[model samples]
Target chain A: MTSSDNTERLVHVPLGERAYDILIGPGLIGRAGGEISTRIKGRKAAIVTDEHVGALYLDPLMDSLQTDGIEAVSISLPPGEKTKSFDSLTKVCDVLLEARIERNDTVIALGGGVIGDLTGFAAGIVRRGVRFVQIPTSLLSQVDSSVGGKTGINTRHGKNLVGIFNQPDLVLADTDVLNTLSEREFRAGYAEVAKYGLIDKPDFFEWLENNWKEVFSGGAARIEAIATSCQAKADVVVADERENGRRALLNLGHTFGHALEAATEYDSRRLVHGEGVSIGMVLAHQFSARLNLASPDDAARVEAHLKAVGLPTRIDEIPGELPSTEFLMDAIAQDKKVKGGKLTFILTRGIGQSFVADDVPASEVISFLEEKRKK
Target chain B: MTSSDNTERLVHVPLGERAYDILIGPGLIGRAGGEISTRIKGRKAAIVTDEHVGALYLDPLMDSLQTDGIEAVSISLPPGEKTKSFDSLTKVCDVLLEARIERNDTVIALGGGVIGDLTGFAAGIVRRGVRFVQIPTSLLSQVDSSVGGKTGINTRHGKNLVGIFNQPDLVLADTDVLNTLSEREFRAGYAEVAKYGLIDKPDFFEWLENNWKEVFSGGAARIEAIATSCQAKADVVVADERENGRRALLNLGHTFGHALEAATEYDSRRLVHGEGVSIGMVLAHQFSARLNLASPDDAARVEAHLKAVGLPTRIDEIPGELPSTEFLMDAIAQDKKVKGGKLTFILTRGIGQSFVADDVPASEVISFLEEKRKK
Candidate 1:
């Protein structure tokens, strides 16, 4: 079903008292103040954004908040994955406290995943948690991070190794924000949009294969895809907010994706998160086929669709020299999903038919990587 | 209830799935591993303690864990309120990560409140949470901080301004450890013991007044008092784990207490937390009397009880010149408990009848402080 440019679809995350809504449409950003004022009781907000996002969207958000009689302040940090660190978290927390952001006041994150993760963490800990709102600016964040309540920072050990599951009171996913993201960045986010289909919505994947161009071009199709993706995620989150059971299904490609990101030393110039996810998704399907769990054609279909949307579908597509298989294996072993030194992966019978596989042999993963690298 | 020295009382905090037991008795520290292993699934443990606590108890605790076939590592921090800071939190988190503390593995806090708060916060965030056990080493911690899931670190803004409600899997409140405490420290903790009585148990308060020496000398009376305090706290916590409602009653004297702690710049020599609470409880009663919430005689009775126990009952009893009334008010205003810029204090009608009073007038507090200084 196609949505109009002005049509805003709402996906409600039902986490009991922690339940909240995600508003997906074109101009939610412009209406942020009125929407936030109606939903959140607080009359004060602190908008945390990066230098790039602040320049593009901060003033409009501030103006909207002021128009609604909400006192708003803004803090801009350097833009990049590097900002998702303990130092940035402490700085954000100190500033939030300095601003006297009370328990009732809101801390609005207005950037990509990095800002949402870091800002949500600060909101969670400051005064033992305060009101949090997510104005996720990228498709990756809007579809995935912002909706999950999984806020955290990267530690020396791994990404998102430290944080709390602080659910947002509301999330405003303005499709218009996508217009500002670079083509590469937008494509990176689409990898996650496509991910929903791979996880459990084969029909959505088939639809994306047919209508991806329209999704990238924007309008009704874009809204439907994002709304669908969020709803799928919300279902998983409501079932397992803490990642104890069914929620591991949401990490369909993350174990492989995270290892690839780590292999590149987290150098965005080489592989941003979603791009790593793209390669990871393909590898997951290919590896499952090697284990005789799925057909090779299913993996080929996923790669073709991802490549059609301009996302890298193979590790060889990544820029610069690749790390050795042993390094990648070490990265995989260190993934936070590891339980009791046993490797867990999201393997599939086919597209949209994934299940969490525990105790996947390290030798199998090693041989799979060795063959894939040679390709 | 009088009991033998071998009697171990258990207070269970039933917070649904987050529920746990507080074991109040002697020799609990010696059986930490056995108790923890039976409850928590993981066999790996990290013991976080203070230098003072570690020097006295680490080896014995480690030996107990080793006996249970649990691999254990210990991190000893500096002993003091100063250790409850963001820097220390980061250090502890890094060490936990370095030790490869996994989600199921337990983080055992083996000291007083400082170690408990800091270690619990780290456990709550590392890998997005792990099993945690608290072995409170002081009377105040055993009776108060260790029971509730209130984990945090102090910031420049105020105490416990950064934290999360991370409950422990088990609390080992070994009364034997309190024997190592200095007299001043034990008395400071006694103030909290008295607070449980003053808050809502007039009978407990009267009982303490009659059997003060027996409770102090340690045995059946001490276990009963500590067990009663834990039960009282657990009841409040089970009812309102997040402090959204009835739990605020538990903060009866903390508002004034925190302000006093801040006035002395959190200097332990001038006033530790429970000492400030002793004075603050009296101040709360006097303020209540001033407001006619209770009779002046009730305030006098409360002050007499605390003073009889060697706790300072008046502001003048604190060492050094106290800050001005306005300065104290500023500290109160900055308290984490303040909501929407209004003062919220735990006021009382009399002993055993404390309640949360919201929107308290700043002017009256100032006048009360001015009058208090004259005493």
Candidate 2:
């Protein structure tokens, strides 16, 4: 559901004492200091961002924090997925500790998922934990990473294999920041936005399907979509913060998406995270149809919507030489979703009707991927 | 109260779903696998130990796991406080992931506080968290660190400045392991045992004073002392696992102790943790008396008992030139117990009557340390 005012929307994640609010609107970044001061009493903040995001928004954020009498120090690392590593994590943590960011002080993630994840993990660990805030500059982080307390750094073993579930004290999803994103980057994030609807919000999916243009153009539709997506995620997180049960649903497209990302060696030039999710979601629906769990029409509809929004809906659309089905299968097996040698995939009956299907046959997945790769 | 069955004792930490058992007995290392298998369903185990502890116990522990049909791998790190570091944490996590230790699989810590804290932190972050067990070898670890799941690594900033409250599925405190400890190390650990009594159990403290030799000689009294200490710790941990309130009482001697340790640059030659704690606890009592909060007779009694056990009851006994009082006060101010520039120390009204003292004047602490240093 869209906000009544639509000027701004606040989604409160009710996680008992760890609960915080996500503010989605146009100028939250400029007012971040004011918003943060109201919730977190700390006067000191360490804003961790990548060079790209920091270049565009750091000055304003620092000024806004200064305006609210909050002393914030910004640490800008080189932009990219590679920055989410132990070296970067140590760097961020060392910087935070060196800054003497106390337990009650704030650590703000002023970039996208990489920054938010690394920053949150640092905030969680430094001094056992400190107050954290997220100023998500990307739609992907706004709807997903910033809302959940899941934070970590990737190791040579795998992505996000090291970290903790550290929730943020506040999240400022300023829609105006999306204007700085390239069209490709914007569309990539849109894949995750579309994912929220496919997970459980059928009406939201229908609304997005009809108003994709307005969301792309940026206005009330974008705010509503972000607000609705945040609320959906917030509900899931509140119910199961640790991913013991219902939280697995939020990984709807992540298993296959992660496998695809890994198969591509996480090369963003070939495919970014949201692009992989867009293709993976379609594959999930198609595989569900193959299993007779859903009609093929539903899969077609998902693919159509994603394609219309400029997201790659098929594995064949990806650039570069595709890995063999065995290679892809190996990657999938290595995903964190596997438990006791059994495959756990989020399948569906139709749109907005995803369910975690456990013990799915690997042979079927192999066969399905083999067929899809040929397309 | 000591266990009725003095041969072996069980202290259960009842933390709802996070609850676990602490088993104090002889030959627990040999029976480690049997104890682990019953509690954790996973068949794979990764035992993290230091060269010191691993040389003594790793073989028996591995053999036990193998006998139980649990696949086990051993990672023996260099023994020292230095092993509780980011480099070691990364190495351990990489090895665990490389071994494909899944979520349900157990990560067992088979050494003292350093190994337990580092391994527990790795187990906590790897795959978001994995099943953890602690087979604490040293008395300090068995009675204190092992019972409480406060896992962390020391940063350049301070000790235990980075970590999480990740409870273990089980703690196996094999009393036999203490037989291999140097008398100094054993006596050092005894300080924490004494601390449990000093916090709230006057009877336990009185019992220790009476049976000090029997407790150190390693038989029924030793097991009884360890069990009682674990129970006291378990009670506090169950009440406040996160150190929000009453748990601060558990740090009865830690604030000043940590300051002393920091002053000595954590040099074990000068002052190990337990020895520092011994001196710190005495100082705490003396400082309380100086504040007119406790009787001077109580401080004398504490000092006498600790001194009789060969523990240093005064900072002057640290076997080296100590730092200035101002330096120690700086370290204390930098401690995790400091909140909003206010000192929060565990002070006492008398024996077995420790309470969290907030906003204790810095002037009083400096004067107390100044007088103690001269003595």
Candidate 3:
């Protein structure tokens, strides 16, 4: 349905009775007030977002909800990765409880991955979990973070070290917010879109290669691309909502990407999530080649595609001692996907053909990373 | 299957792929060292427990693991409800990671509900959830907290405000450990045993009522009771692990129980979890009566049964301003089972039947509580 300048398309993530909807389109943010007001069935609600997004949209969002006669308040954190820590989560819960948010009242997550993750985690913890809605304002969030039920903040030990698989009752992805993003930010977001192709949708990758220019320029195809990407994510999430088997494939580039973000301090100026993901995908392709799982030509082709879209395909963009092979391997070993001490890596044999390899020994990963470092 | 001086039968919760064993028997604590050594798959492990529990079992438990060549360390917190705060969780994560505990390693939660909740929460957040084993030392824990995948610590605003539903790899319930418990502590554990009946298993509750003296006197049935209770819990969890439906009925007394615990400063000396639950069940029965959903005579019988078993059945013993109706109502509204701002309370329609009521208004609950106070 169209609301003024906004449109809505719902992607259903099948999780049995716990299934949820990812509502995609512009003006979805303003519609959040009515959608949540009707769905949440609570008189009271709280909006948890970062300062930047809150300052930009919190008033309008709250006003729209208030127009529905729903009591709404916003708790904004300083916009950064630091806001995704335990202390920040505790503070959010404090504000929520102080405002007397009943467990039935929805927690609105506004902003990018950081806000969505922290808000979801906070909602998960408060009284062992409360309902929440995701209002993703960033491209990285609209297609990826907003669709998954994964929510958590980082700990000093590592990123997303604390969190849960708490799904949101609804996800409102407003493409209009893309107007605020820079060209680099827009490209950074495509990393995840490309991810779908690398892991499970090679045909989509061909489509992406064909439409990269128009999508980059925010053409009509851009909205459909974003919505379709979310649908892809939603479909996989519904099948493996808890990241048991099929879900691990979604981490095609995340292992390497997360390590890059860790080394680069998770700063947009140095390494946006999308950029790290781009480099990570390249590393995965290279690693696949070193293991003889895929050909070097496959790596070169993927690199060419990312480069054509202005995404980073190399690790040297930031000047930091590429963490020792031991460090990255160790971090990957501690990944959430590890089970019974077996580390599983989501590696691609070719576009749209990825597999989980738990037998990829630590020593082999280290040796492969070392080869890349030497080159 | 035999261990040195085994006095109990270990019935493992058979979740197939998510399987975990429950070690039920006497003198299991002293043998916990060997049991844990045999079950854990890794060498580096962290034992997260509270101060009181640590002082009691830490030395023996660590010595056992060490004997098995498992390098183990522990992070202990002050023994109380407040220790479950986020600050303590951060501390535990820091110490565990500092100990170089790997994702392949396991965490042993040693204590009552508080420790299980805190350690489990830490494990879930530590590298996106690690393997944990519940070594429940108290009867309350052995029968309730240790079996379910529910794990989390509390926040200042409420009890169990921050947590996750992460199950353990094993649950070692050593009945011999109950020998160390105070008379009051021992009785507090029975509150949950009674809950199995209120939820769905009336036969079990009937058995408990018939053998309260034997169960309390530490009869041989004690081991069977613990195992049976774990089995009951397992069956429900396997059917609906995340508490979306029938599982929530297991929270028969928790709505009022949590409110009672919150009113008691989370201090065991004042109001243990079992005691709170005992009183809570009575209130729930009364609430059922107030709504004409159950007979008032059934409420009295439940209270009498609890009193006969040396459990608390009155709010007057809570030693507070009886917790304002609004406060209790607010806490109930913030319960995890709430949906769309409507609180769901598990109310008994008869001695062995319970159903969830979502439309119960706050005013009705307060008036019913006031009438109980007058009575």
Q: Which is the winner by lDDT between candidate 1 and candidate 3? A: 1
- What candidate 3 gets wrong by more than 4 Å, as runs, is A1-9, A37-40, A244-246, A254-256, A286-297, A319-348, A351-375, B1-20, B30-40, B67-69, B100-104, B191-210, B228-273, B276-375
Error of 1 at B142 (Å): 0.4
**Share of native interface contacts recovered by each model:** 0.90, 0.84, 0.72
Residue pairs in steric clash, candidate 3? A104-B341, A125-B161, A127-B161
- Alpha-carbon runs more than 4 Å astray in model 2: A2-5, B2-5
- Taking the tens digit of each residue's C-alpha lDDT, what string does model 2 give over A237-356? 999898988888888778888888988889999999999999899999999999999999999999999999889988878888877788888888888878999989999999999999
Which tens-of-lDDT digit does each residue in A96-215 have in candidate 3?
Answer: 877777667778898999999999888877766777888898888988988878888776667776677788888888888888888888889888998888888888888888888867
Per-candidate TM vs. native? 0.98, 0.98, 0.84
DockQ of each: 0.88, 0.82, 0.47
Tens-place lDDT digits, model 3, residues B216-259: 76747777677778888888888888677888878888888888
Interface root-mean-square deviation of model 2 in angstroms is 1.0
The local distance difference test score of model 2 is: 0.90
DockQ of model 3, rounded to 2 decimals:
0.47
Question: Which lDDT tens digits does candidate 1 get at residues A1-375?
Answer: 555564889999889999999999988888999998898888889999999999999999999999998998889999998899989999999989888888888999999999999999999999899899999999899899998899999888778889999999999999999988899999999999888899999999999999999988888898999999999999998888889988999888888899999889889889998999999999999999999999999999999999988999998988899879999999999888888899999999999999999989999999999999988
Instruction: Give me candidate 2's TM-score against the actual structure.
Output: 0.98
